[model samples]
Target: MSVLLEVQGVTKTFGGVVANQSVSIEVRAGEIAGLIGPNGSGKTTLFNSIVGAHAIDEGSIKFEGEEISTFRVPVIARKGMLRTFQQTRIYGEMTALENMRISAPEARVSALSLLGGFSSKTDTRGEELLEFVGLASKRFLRAGALSFGQQKLLEFAMALMSEPKLLLLDEPTAGINPTLINGLIDRLKQANKELGVTLLVIEHNMRVIMNLAERITCLAHGEVLASGTPDEVRNDPRVVDAYLGAG
Candidate 1:
């Protein structure tokens, strides 16, 4: 597989505290990769630096062979490296369809125009995205009114509005019912298969990660403890010692 992104010696620090330490990882095109770690292991910090949510104090980030460490959040997002937070960031007052419109970067019309009323182009795009996420029936409902699972799906749809190439999902299945978990996973799989989008997921849900990820990277205490296939990671002594054992 082709390399989609590369992180080399990436490190982040806030004052005297180091959040990430010489971390290096890679994602391949058209593959679902997993990043698993204990809390405060720098999983999210590494992801933030990659997506320009946080700037690295040292090291470099390359996407598709081009350096993007200096790019801002919007700049990186425009380049097709998009990320979603663990929390669903949806416009609560707006209908699901309208919430999707809010995330449509292509809608260059005035924000005041939207406050008054949205354009046909934005409305159409919103509906299309809602349909894409299996929320077409709920399109007219307020985002806050929908069940948590539905809201999560809505957020996923909005993130996909930019037509991202590499999607970084932060703990996507953190808090949801088992029934909805499968639905979310199915949508992610479809996104990868149908849209040809690569994915890097940070998840603590071992079953979900093992089922979906092509490869897994394990981190502990701000360092990569192991990197391998699911089976390999499951059996690694270091991984067991660092993460899988009884606490």
Candidate 2:
């Protein structure tokens, strides 16, 4: 597969502390890639740089062959790339379907225009995605009322409303009930296979990432430590050492 996103020697520092130092990784098109690292290994820091949540100190980030390292979040998001947070993001007061409608890139609806803002087309697609994430019955329920797992599913559907070509998922299985994770994994696979959305997931759950991604990259101390398939990465002594040291 062709490379979809490339982060070459990227670095980021907060004040004087380096969060990522010479970190590099590549994610290919049409594949689910896993990014694994222990706490404070700069996993989320790298995601922020790639997704334009913050500026990188050095190096390059290219998506679909275009340099986007300097671009801001909205601009990058408009370019058919988007990301989901570990903590779910939704309008707590809004109903699930209402949140989905507003999530569309075209929505731009004001607080006063809530019910009248969405067109029938947006409504239909929103409902379909709600069903896709197994939230059809919760359509009219307030987003904040949903359980954490359900809220994450709602957030996933919201991201899909934009049809992102590449979706960066940060700790997708975190905070989710173990029983719900399998269903979440299935939805992620379905999104990749059926909707043609590529995924780059940052996960601490070893079992989940191992099962989800075709390839994996591991980072430690803000640098790339290993990169390969599930078995290869799992067997790398450097990777094992990093995790062990983290604990």
Best by lDDT: 2
Error of 2 at 124 (Å): 1.4
Q: Estimate, for each residue in 1-247, the C-alpha lDDT of model 1 and write its tens digit.
A: 9899999999899888788888999999999999998888889989889989877999999999999999988888878888988877778888988777767765434545456555688778778878877899999898999987778788889888767899999998877788778878888898899889899999999999999898999988788888999999989888888875655
Error of 1 at 97 (Å): 0.5
Write down the RMSD of all candidates, one decimal each.
2.8, 2.5
212 Cα displacement, candidate 2 (Å): 0.1
For residue 149, what is the lDDT in candidate 2? Answer: 89
Model 1 worst lDDT run, 10 consecutive residues: 107-116
lDDT of 1 at 44: 90
Distance from true position, residue 8, model 1, in Å? 0.6
Write candidate 2's Cα lDDT for 1-247 as tens digits: 9999998999999998888999889999999999999999899999999989999989999999999999999889989899999878888999999889888867533445555645899899999999999999999999999999899999999999988999999999999999989999999999999999999999999999999999999998888899999999999998999988743
Off by over 4 Å in 2: 108-117
Residue 62 alpha-carbon offset, candidate 1, angstroms:
0.7
Worst 10 residues of 2 by lDDT: 108-117
Pairs in steric clash, model 1: none
